[model samples]
Target chain A: MKVLNEMSVNFESRSVNEAFARTAAAAFAAQLDPTVAELNEIRTAVSEAVTNCVVHAYRDTIGIISMNIRIAEGNILIVKIRDRGCGIEDIPRAMEPLFTTSPEDERAGLGFAVMQSFTDKLTVRSKPGKGTTVTLEKRLSPRLSDV
Target chain B: MLLKPKTMFDGKVLTVYLSGDIDHHSARRIREYTDALIGELKPVRLLLNYSAVSFMDSSGIGLIMGRYRMMKLYGGSVSVVSIPPALRKMMELSGLGCLDVLEGGNEENESA
Candidate 1:
């Protein structure tokens, strides 16, 4: 098959990245007759992840955020967002469902857990002085045969 | 309008820039727009621009990874850029960086 598809964005924390992610994912789901339940779950996961970044990632300063999405077929989809500001040195501690980097921010730290549950495949990468990217992949259920 | 797709394209690639929160309310929208772009524009490559994006959870990841696989199927590649620092570390700890992710639009090469 012909390959190579991509996109980019330059934005700051105030841009409402979570809203964008939801709209985009919902748009992608409409292509197939996604179940109402599935759609709801997906959108929630997106919001949770975005809120984490906005609430805890950027802090008080306005910073840049990037989100990328791909649909391989009618059955599977992928979405990833990355930013370079303050890297998370301890992922395990952070991924702990109840762990919050900033308790002062009232961050539940459940974002990662929720995202993991929603998507069939979830991956996160980062460097101390670099950035972090959250990648999620899912296989649509009740397949209709064409994607 | 439930979801309106806005795109940025280079002759060899196409990038869809999304904003706001990506949650149960909008995952499907992103999916449909992507399918249309791939079907109609038929660019040699496609990418999702998540820089301006502020929030996202697993549904967000689902959207990104799904697209990555899509581009891979066509032989093209998918990429993520400008992820915030704290969020970037989260992805790394989760091992989600196995794919393609770029820092600050550095135009460098990275993968999920």
Candidate 2:
């Protein structure tokens, strides 16, 4: 298959990787003529999803989180974030808002919810212990609009 | 990511100004500091001046919700002021409007 326009990156620490993902996504979306708000929605949504992989999936362990940024159908932006860490056991239960298995931590279980809130679409595929992949899809607008 | 808390009126109205980006990593600390300050200062009111905040994600929402919860218990109110229109939309969708997310400055309560 022929590869389209895309960006791939990796980081050792979770602290800066999410920021880098958003920055990289913004740079790409900006070139596509998306408004700042739309870009932010895409960026923040991607960041939240990726951060989930970092903080929850792997728990800040040493792993490579991969991001694939590609434009789809002229106006849609798609991002796939995957991590080879401890995967999710129950997909449906985990997707629920405020559903965190870890109560010892202060997680609000808003990571996936926030991603879903900002993005046009989101899909999570995971196993019990192998790894997890979170895909975020957004339809970009020409300009950033505030309602 | 620097946190600047501006104390006004003998520390009656404590407005904590957050700059830079708010995300998963920073949300934890922000929540901790905010809760500690709220307990210690015990202000009459609180406001999050996000004027300098360049970016925020879902973690930001959690922090705001946490503060809102804390404020309710103390009989005080927490307001978000000077939000950029883009960020404002996020707040609006998150039910901050129904929760009464303030949209103006402290001018309304200056004389209070």
lDDT of 2 by residue, B1-112 (tens): 6454443435777777777888877777777887888899898788787876778886777778778888889989988887766676566556567778566533555323
Q: How much lDDT does each candidate structure score?
A: 0.64, 0.75
Give the per-residue lDDT digits (tens) of candidate 1, residues B21-78: 5543365677777877886766777767665565555546656656766777777877
Candidate 1 positional error at A19, Å: 2.3
Model 1: per-residue Cα lDDT at residue A127: 82
Off by more than 4 A, model 2: A1-3, A102-106, A142-147, B3-9, B73-75, B101-112
Runs in model 1 with CA error above 4 Å?
A1-10, A145-147, B1-112
Residue A30's lDDT in candidate 2? 75
Cα lDDT tens digits, model 1, A1-147, are: 221344455456653566665666667666655776567556766566566666656767777878776666546667777777666888888788757665443243567787787778788787876778888777667556553
Query: Which CAPRI tier for candidate 1?
Result: incorrect
Considering every candidate listed, which one attains the maximal lDDT?
Answer: 2
